[model samples]
Target: MWAVASLLPARRMLASAPRGDGRPVMLLPGLVNSDRSLFLMRRYLRRLGYDAVGWGLGRNLGARAIGGEGERLLARVARLHEESGQTVTLVGVSLGGIMARFVAHRLPEAVREVITISSPYAGDPRATRVWRMFERLTGERIDAEGVVARRVEIARPLPVPATAIWSRSDGLVNGLICRDPEEDGCRAIEVRSGHLGVQIRPAVLRTVADILAVPGQGPLGTFRP
Candidate 1:
């Protein structure tokens, strides 16, 4: 059985709604997703009084050009950091989360914290689905020795305070991988929601608000039993 404390209603945890001074936060969407994917979360964060923005880059099925895309993301993060004079928190879902980790590693000066939703930082070699054909078509290889190894390295003892939210019901990445190998600055929380719906789920929204409210609490700040 899943370790879900409750399945009927996904729990919503909010440390306290943020006060709107338009603090900057970047929301990176999952694989096969676009900036619009974070629409709901953006709206919720705005309501809670935060200036949450999307990662503007187009379709994010996977890291097409690690070099180019990574640079683009890093530059954008740097801009946000300069504009806000605040350490912009990185919130990514799925592949976006993986990308966020890379950006954070390269530009720690620009990142505050990293929160991932159902993201498999430790390379899910089981991605044997039809979607991967796009990876081949686009020449993006997640299985490359260097790529997989880097992901594994960053996945454990994560370069930053990492918070992972996952569900056994996830039809995508294995939730087990969401658990941090070391517990010091990492946390793994269980949520009840489908893989795709996680972005819009109310419980996830509340959890996000709670987590963001804390300056440096890392993941699972929206703790619940």
Candidate 2:
């Protein structure tokens, strides 16, 4: 099933793979998304002097019931590490950001840097009455307190350079979920976008490209205007 589903992205990506070797980058899609959802971005990254890979993990339906997904993420990074001498940089969107963080935690040796797009790292499942309804309708199992506490723990002295790319216009997850951390490895950046567009927004695309361009810098580089 996924083999056929992967065709479109593969064809789309092939049109731009010649420039794809120096660095290794992995684009991890958001909730309920498959590797196909990140096709375009992967293609662009591959075109930008990087060997880009899709998470290929089917979907990012929050961490529940299913156990060991974190281990799977680490395995993926390890695979990439074996192929390339350096660690892989992660670019995750929404819930995938959480997965990326978890992966970095278990396999810091395999991760060079991490960047999250519009993820609710701070937690805001009940920031607004509307969100409760949103959760009910979407079946988002968000235990804000649990998520926040867990994230805070993962956040202390983050293992790699990390950046949270957020937008005030994000509607799904509360925009305020974007946070600033004084830890040298973590930084928060603000963009103008809606949650769903975080992956395709033009400004974001440019930012992602520029971030990938820095030398000796992981996916998260010094903030640029």
Candidate 3:
């Protein structure tokens, strides 16, 4: 997928990708992933004229890393918003997207938009293949107070624009769990890629770029499969 995506030069073909506004973008990597994993996505956003920045909080340690207002993840987001002088567009991949939803819910004023890629935030955690691994990593069982409460919290609508990008081909998380709630400000876009490929696939990149270029509530534009 990466090789084929590289050959497409999709960025060049995406004439509408350029925002020209230089909005600040914060990318959160998936579970067990770090800023390094999002290098390609962030670089692409930067090239399209957005101030794309990584979470910079090291590998995402699941609930423990972003479970509370006083955690490292929140602190980093606060610092970025303060320094950027702009509302940030939070973009997260897989588990990182779930974290982004939590951040957006907590600090809506600091976030302009929230985008999640293949994140299973709205359904049974057991539906995901990684739930057991997630439990081991975060030490928080699916039924635990904090984890359950957080699931409910993230499922609520964000005050900012929200987009959920899901793929039927995803093998990690159930695609249905990635759907946007029945709310006016939120929308879901379906892509043709695997869970990980959603990050680097050219079509997915074009879709993301197009979404970011739009100004208001989204599903702003559509892309071909």
lDDT leader: 3
Task: Please write out the lDDT profile of model 1 over residues 45-74, one tens digit for every residue.
Answer: 887788799988777745563343477778
lDDT of 2 at 12: 38
- Single out the weakest 10-residue window by summed lDDT for candidate 3: 215-224
Pairs with steric clashes in candidate 1:
32-61
Global Cα RMSD, each model: 4.6, 6.4, 2.2
Model 2: lDDT to the true structure: 0.67
TM-scores, all candidates, are 0.82, 0.75, 0.91
**Backbone clash numbers for all candidates listed:** 1, 0, 0
Candidates sorted on lDDT, descending: 3, 1, 2
Relative to the true structure, candidate 1 reaches a TM of 0.82
Candidates in order have lDDT scores of: 0.70, 0.67, 0.81
- Better TM-score candidate (1, 2): 1
- Identify the runs in model 2 with alpha carbons over 4 angstroms from their true place: 1-21, 64-66, 128-149, 215-225
Alpha-carbon shift of residue 197 in model 2 (angstroms): 2.2
- Candidate 2, residue 26: how far the Cα is off, in Å: 0.8
lDDT by residue (170-205, candidate 2, tens digit) is 887776665455556676777777776568655566
